[model samples]
Target chain A: MMRGLAVASTLIVVLIALALFMRSKPILALKPLTTLLFSTAWHPSRGEFGFLAFIAGTLWVTLVASFIAIPVCILASIYLSEYADKRLREWIGPFIDILAGIPSVVYGMWGVLVIVPLVKNIIAPLFGGYSAGYSVLAGGLVLAVMISPVIIHISVEVLRTVPSDLKQASLALGATKWETIKFVVMKRAMPGMIAASVLGLSRAFGETIAVMMVVGNVARIPRTVFDPAYPLPALIANNYGEMLSIPLYDSGLLFAALLLLLVVIYFNVVSKMILSGSKWSLYYNG
Target chain B: MDKKNNIHVRRLEENIFKSLMVFSTGAIVLALALILWTVIRKGLPHLSLGMLTQAPKSGYYLGKDGGILNAILGSLYLTGGAALLAILVSLPVVLYLNVYLKKGSPLAYIARFSFDILWGIPSIVYGAFGFTIMLLFGVKSSLLGGMIAVTFLIFPIMSRSMDEVVRMVPGELMDASYALGATKLETAFKVVVRQALPGISTAVLISFGRGIGDAASLIFTAGFTDSLPTSLLAPAATLPLAIFFQFGTPMPEVQGRAYASALTLTLIILVISVAARLLTRKFTKHVV
Candidate 1:
């Protein structure tokens, strides 16, 4: 009973802290929160909060990042989980495991020393100077690669768990191997696939360090993939350590975090419900 | 004979696709290998004990060795202590959550909502929150503050993984243990825990690697320190933070060392993850 009390109290401390920190009155008193986040200027040192340029830039980069990631990862997961031979699967699984473990710092270092120069020197002229050094294209492209392993892992797990009896029954009814996989396995795994994709989306939504190093941190919406922009996490990372005040301090920083927290929680709940709610029907359908 | 002919064609088609699959898989392997090679190329040639034993040294080409030794010790002290603390707290809460909370309860749903939200809040948010708490307590850049940030970052993972390993302990086993006159605690500690130990261990290892590899979260909460971590109450340097610091600075040697340090960190994470997966394989085999 004492142990239970202890656990409950601890949880209450953390949750209540979050609420108190994000209370409505406290939030509104800080800055014109919307104007800060949505403004076109972001010259904090000069007292301009035009973040519209950065806000748009961040979303564009993330969208393109996820766009590049989702398709390749979906294909890779399908191939690895469904089509690869036993020996190949054995090898492929561990390879991806290590890939997932590669730190973001390493990815950032590679982008800085190698990829930035390529964009600035070789790729820029091709894109009409839009591919200028350390652009969003470099950051988003690196992020696409960085997040692929996560997508593959989740999708492959969902695929691997598709009930074998479904495949057998489909095949038993004269369906081709491909047809069985396409109609039955894919159908059965659709919800889990959605869960996996949502998970991937969350990873993309808040990726920072590497994105910061390579994205150029310019406070403007990129006209093309080659232009640079700042993101919420990157913004915090780039300026948080140096920042020291109220109109541009912890509250503003926490507000961005609050935004990330709310969105992430929503998707997480959606995915959990999708998983648990559909598991029964998927079992029956399979 | 006709069956044999069909098998031959099928074999040929399978072989072609197999090659494609192998090539694709190889592509991923090649990417990781290239990253490691780049790190070593950029970092190893300049690596020395100076990078690990002294303060954040800069201007290596000018014979200056900005040492990261303090950061190395600091990262270890902070991440290690925090991991131990998180495990102690989260393991039981997770087990209790699994054993008693009764899935789908409003309380359970709320608990889960918070856990998932914790995962989604980026590392920077954690840093910001930790910074607030620190300012509230008047303890900035201390290892304790870093631990606070890390505990939040890792708690959700530990609990979620625990919930998974526990729930996967086939309900039939629990029923049998109860039928044999075992209490809930007895059944949990003996039968369910033993059965799922492998999975739980893997989960712990995964979180351990995550805690160690994190740089952004710890940076603000625990600013860089120049001396050996004599106490958990002092600021310190971690490998990830050192890499971030070096990346922006103008020292070829420091830059190289940053790569090397990042390489080391990645290697550590990879090893833990591999071990976790291998351990998980045993439990899954049992699970199936």
Candidate 2:
């Protein structure tokens, strides 16, 4: 019974992939896949169907989010695994869980209510000489908050898998805790930490509602952090309801989903490779 | 004396670095508290019994008259159905990974890899996929379509978490069960299932919370209706969508209702997370 179910699970994934490919096949023939990938003019009503703007938007938001999440997450994981006592660890675990469990829509609401105003009133004006707030910066900040918990959780696990004796040996030799962590533990855990960041990037790229609510959803390539941009997932979520009203619009959105799928698959495959190559199956042993 | 000076400098740097990390961890706690505080401060006053039990009437978006009962019930129905489907599909696949196949088999590897990909694929893409399937089947955005999309959304999370739990079960215990002349299927169902029941339950509720709170995945597939759905074929309104719609409206009263709906959704998720944590702790005492 279990074997049959396992095969069925594999089959289900293939079926979804095939269905997505077939749905996007129509647009595939009209334009070269490369053109679809590089063009940014997404005016479905005018039959202009470039997705470059969304791609750029996703990259900008995700990169900014990574900039904020990666360093903070790595430092926190090191502290949680190496420096913190049992009490601090206990206090932080549930907070991480609560952060992870909060819904994206709620985050979107928070973005709309809080982050956008902060950016509009303070950061954008202070940094960019203006205040639209609903720009890539706000979206990136919200995404940073959303994906940090994920990166921290997985990274802490990866760091914990390093043998305790390695650390103890370094300490016994009079090496400081920071030196042991920097020279030994961090080196051993580098691959897993990279995997954690990759996972967080994949998530930030695919986040829809929160990014959508703050990203301003304009189909233009952003020239500054204060400029509005349209990420691919946001494009699909915002236009999907009205897609049938225009010619080839549904197909365009379907192709966008297909594109997002490919990118996400690539990231996940990379992260999985790192996890497996790290030779520490403590987390992925499942 | 120079060595002592170097030691002092490094110690100072270490202390500074440690404080930075502590601040970052504290920031996460602060962020959660701030989110809850904002939602509750704005939402608590508008939360009423009618919001839970009555359907929205005409001019509801204008804050004229009505409640979010349709959305509340619809969310429950959709999540309940999706959770059931996720369990049925996830249990056997997870069992196959741990029980039927040995570690590092190609088929098992593919199953795990594919689920990881699916797990990372955003909920909005699942909405598109569901919309495509609905088009092919000639079905409108309805309860069934929403359930299908959400099942896909939560299936990987359910299976992967459960797989971890099952992996932690001692191999010797399973070997001992087989030594008793139990068939592989019997051993899996009788011994493995019982051993992982608490973890399995936690996975179920986690998936349930995920399905319940998701909005983008349901927007195009489930569609929306002001009235409660009477059948799987009918359109259904969910709490997240309700919040989305209300917030989009220009009226302050309705926007307040949006916050109330958000608080409702947050509280539900909090309950599930707390329950799952408690269940894991309580059941760990009995697990071998």
The candidate maximizing lDDT is 2
Instruction: Give the lowest summed-lDDT range of ten residues in model 2 chain B.
Output: B24-33
Superposition error at B65 for model 2 (Å): 2.2
Query: Which sections of candidate 2 miss by over 4 Å?
Result: A277-286, B1-5
lDDT of 2 by residue, B1-288 (tens): 686549888999889999998888777668768888888898999999988888999988888888999999999999999999999999988887888898889998888878877888889888989988999999999999999999999998898889879888889989999999998788788999999999999889888887898998998899899998899999999999999889888899999899989999999988988888889889999898
- Chain A TM-score per model, please list them: 0.84, 0.95
lDDT of 2: 0.86
Residue lDDT tens for model 2, A26-119: 8887888888888876778888899899899999999888998889888888888888899989878777766578888889899899999998
Docking class of 2: medium
How many pairs collide in each candidate, listed in order? 12, 0
Worst 10 residues of 2 chain A by lDDT: A277-286
- What's the distance in Å from true for residue B68, model 1? 2.6
After superposing candidate 1, which stretches have Cα over 4 Å from the reference? Answer: A1-27, A30-34, A45-48, A127-130, A165-184, A246-248, A278-286, B1-27, B48-63, B102-106, B170-195, B281-288
**lDDT by candidate, in order shown:** 0.71, 0.86
DockQ of each: 0.33, 0.60
> What are the TM-scores, per candidate, against the unseen true structure?
0.85, 0.96
